[model samples]
Target: AHVITHYHRTIDKVTERFLGKRQIGTTGRGIGPTYADKINRVGIRIQDIFDENILRQKVEAALDQKNHLLVKVFNRRAIDADEVVESLLSFADRLRPMVADTGLEIHRALERGETVLFEAGQATMLDVDHGTYPFVTSSSATAGGAATGSGIGPGKLERIIGIVKAYTTRVGAGPFPTELFDESGEFLRANGFEFGTTTGRPRRCGWYDAPIARYTARVNGVTDFVLTKLDVLTGLSTIPVCVAYEVDGVRVDEVPVNQSDFHHAKPVYEEFPGWTEDITGARTFEDLPKNARDYVLAVEAMSGARISAIGVGPGRDAIVVRHDLLGAS
Candidate 1:
């Protein structure tokens, strides 16, 4: 578990600023530092807030080192332990009612034959250990993480459904092999509304990268894929899908083992005929246009997972299910 403080954000800003051009494009929300504190055993847990002395001691101990780094190394002001303690303690009353042994509760639900759905906050490409190194999020963002984060046994888990867009869009900085720098990029960005949910920054748009999808399927053991934003690519003459990558002029069928190779990889595209239909009202797979159905089938064949559902529009009910998500294998 990770806990965040005011100093954590400050630390994030300072450290990132120090790194200059080489900074990892984090949200600057103190997530990385909070995780670092947890690993370093200097983190403030939620339970510590109920005890003022324990909270104060932990805060002081953490600040003892952090303050030195701030002042001596970063040339910044030291954070006050008292201020941090007071700020944390302020949320105790509201948090007390919500705090529980969630793992135990989940187990109880499982024993009662109730369904439990674990939703990850980030994508597989942003997973700490399995994703692109240093460019990934602070923790695991895969099916295995669902068990670890929820304190559930790995053997008890089933049905890892991957949600992917019709095309690719990456926020912040990283190597995107299929990234578009032309009008096609702008067109996808405009139609897909490719913007960050939190930052409101315009996303880097690209053609669908099937190699990355295949990589995700292998790593996460994806049982099904929910293809979203299919309607966005409606009027294109032809849609390009990256079936493979060319690293140093050598064609590779999957993601590279080395980060340098991945960074330099170029997309090998396979063009799919586009559709001109308005698919939002379509409730069944049969209602889709021939070209749209072909595109889905082609992507599914390459993606290494059955596409269980296809999102036709942004509405809650704007989906066509080919297979049952909870009932099917």
Candidate 2:
């Protein structure tokens, strides 16, 4: 019944200043720096905010190196320690009530035969340890991260559900094998409204890369997939799916082991017949067009995970559920 909020974002500064022109295109929300502080053992916690002296001391210590980098390296204004401390203190009364030992609570709940769900931010391709490397986020984004990020044990997590868009889209820089430069990419972007939910940045659209989906499924031990935005594929004459990648004259069925190989990977496409009918009103999987049903089955076979649910439209009830996600019979 409780949620765990890891790391602190009392300061808004990030390591983007260090990246210079070769920036990884972060959202500039200080997430990188906050996680950096956690690893560096200098991060302030939610509990620290309640103690005025401890809060001020930690903020001052963190800003000591940060302000130096901003002023000398980035040529940015130095952040005042008092201002940062004061800003954090202002949220103490409001956040204190919500703060709890979420990990312990979740563990206890599961011990009592209650269900505990662990949701994650970002995608597997954006994981810091296992993803596209320098182009990834600051933390672990895969299922393995769920154990470390939250204080829950990995054995307790029996199911890993991956939510995938029917078509591919990426917000920032990375190696994308299926990126389309023509009208087809634009059509998906426009119809799906492919934009970053928080930053509003336009996402790069592409065809579904089954190889990438399979790679994620393998890495995360995904049991089921919730396929989304299937309705946006409507009205197209044909749909090209990236079944594999051609890297350096060789067909790579799996994700390349090295970043260089991934960057140069070329998509090997498998074209499927498209549907022209509007399927937003479809309530069941059987209600979908035969071509659409075939496409879903083909993707499921390639993805290495069962398609438990399919999102046909934007509404809450638009999902076509095939199985219970909670493992209930």
Candidate 3:
């Protein structure tokens, strides 16, 4: 939600209108608008959901501010607080039993040695503070955010599994170092189906960037990498990976702090042979195409983290494993 409506407020109104359409590839989820409210501290949670009196006051306060912004800046229609409150109150029957201490529940489960899989939204490159500034998502989407977002202590976080694309991609606006603007970009986008899962916007595609991956691994304390979308690279004559960047005639090993330097940085490419045919059903390391294996090895060397599992396609069993850091039962 925070990833989608970080800037605009009309997302809810617009998205809600397209509830049944398959045009946007979305189901009119209210996630983005709700997250926006959470950041503004005007969100009515499940707890506030119970008490209508408190919920009424809360909705009125939020609507007051929202309507002001809508009328003054966007030149939009004003929202009625009473109407909004009444609509929200209508959901009280379904939301009652679902409201509980989720953090406490997690703690109890952990005490019993039950494994908890904490799934995160978006990728590290989309994270607000760590990723490309101003163009990034409003919240932390990296592995580190799992602790706070899930209401678990940092100590409970035993490992951070970083999911990376075989090639790099980004949505909206940002400084993408290896973004391919030519036929290669289009090919990757088409083959990989490189589009935002949330917004359905076409992703900016590029070769695998080792420097950015290294930075992400270090910053997120990633124990392992689960490289996805590898099968998209099949049947290519050659493949290129960005091993380093040349900024102002000087080569850098890591991502630079200066935005200007990053903007001006030229990718120093390392080329490899592209594999023909598919290896999506491969279950073991040796089952991969020879060139595909080389690509993973090249990435592992530069990423500064072990390659645990490689996702060839978007299937539950599509990933081939070298090792599983989260462990296999």
* RMSD (Å) per prediction: 0.9, 2.9, 4.9
**Candidate 2: where is the Cα deviation over 4 Å?**
1-21
- Model 1 C-alpha RMSD vs. true structure (Å) is 0.9
Question: Per-residue lDDT of 75-180 in model 2, one digit per residue for the tens?
Answer: 7678787877777788889998998888888889989999877788899999998889888888888999889877988988889999999989998888888998
Q: Write the per-residue lDDT of candidate 3 for residues 1-329, one digit (tens) a residue.
A: 11222223464555445444423222245555667788878777766656889977887787777777677765678877677667667777886776678899999999999988898777786677887765555578887788878789988888788888889988766688899999999999999998888768898999999999999998898888888888999988999989999999999878988877888888999999999878888989899978899989988999989989988877899989888676742
lDDT per residue, candidate 1, 9-125, as tens digits? 999989988988888888888989999999899999999988999999999999999999999999988999999999999999989898899999999999998889999888888
* Residue 124 of model 2, lDDT score: 91
The most accurate candidate by lDDT is 1
Candidate 2 RMSD to the correct structure: 2.9
Stretches > 4 Å off in candidate 3: 1-40
TM-score of each: 0.98, 0.94, 0.87
Candidate 1 residue-pair clash tally: 0
Candidate 2 has a TM-score of 0.94
Provide the overall lDDT of each model, using Cα atoms, as 2-decimal numbers. 0.93, 0.85, 0.79
Top-down lDDT ranking: 1, 2, 3
C-alpha positional error of residue 30 in candidate 1 after TM-score superposition, expressed in Å: 0.4
Clashes of each: 0, 0, 1
Worst 10 residues of 3 by lDDT: 1-10
